[model samples]
Target: MARKGGELEAFIAFLGGLLAAGLAALAMAGIGLAVRPTPALKSAALVTLGAIWLTVTTTVYLRIKPRSS
Candidate 1:
């Protein structure tokens, strides 16, 4: 039977987006770190920000799930 999308799917999507963003940030960090010492700070900042966002995303997902029957 077909099923309507639910919070789980939303959570999964949110996680995927977070992961993609983190990967992009990491790549940028690598490139930046390669360029100059100043960019290294930006690199660390972005990676940390991305990790924080990922943690928030997971927390939100836990909040969204309803109690199981």
Candidate 2:
């Protein structure tokens, strides 16, 4: 069904990616803030979480996005 409407499919994928990434970021931030570790540890934790978030988001986006014909 999605294959027939390429542009619309792509747009949907874009929105999905944005939503997924945003939610992931918020979750990570909440976790980091809730823990309230030492400054150095907090920095390291947030950085690690951010990297994981980016990787997951990009993977999702690529998996959902349609390829050019």
Candidate 3:
């Protein structure tokens, strides 16, 4: 049905966006390591960034409209 097709399209788009954001977050974490020379600081920064990214992605995915269908 048309509704199912639309839902599928929205789901696919959501997945694509999630993938892109994940990649970007990883790149940012890698860059963060270079910004902080101390090992402790680097670890902390990466962990914080990872946690924030996971939280944001989960929230966005949950709020995606297609799933409501």
Top TM-score hit:
2
Backbone clashes in candidate 2 total 0
lDDT score, candidate 2, position 54: 59
Model 3 misplacement above 4 A: 1-5, 37-69
Q: Candidate 1, clashing residue pairs?
A: none
lDDT of 1: 0.69
Kindly give the stretch of ten consecutive residues in candidate 1 with the minimal lDDT sum.
1-10
Candidate achieving higher TM-score, 1 or 2: 2
Task: Report the C-alpha lDDT of model 2 over 1-69, residue by residue, as the tens digit.
Answer: 435535665566556656766776687678767886688976776676566655665666577666776
lDDT, residue 47, candidate 1: 72
**What does candidate 1 score on TM?**
0.47
Clashes of each: 0, 0, 0
CA displacement after TM-score superposition, residue 61 of candidate 2 (Å): 0.8
Every model's TM-score = 0.47, 0.47, 0.47
Q: How does residue 42 of candidate 1 score in lDDT?
A: 76
Minimum summed lDDT over a 10-residue window in model 3 is located at: 1-10
lDDT of 3 by residue, 9-56 (tens): 556556655675677678767877678557786677667656665665
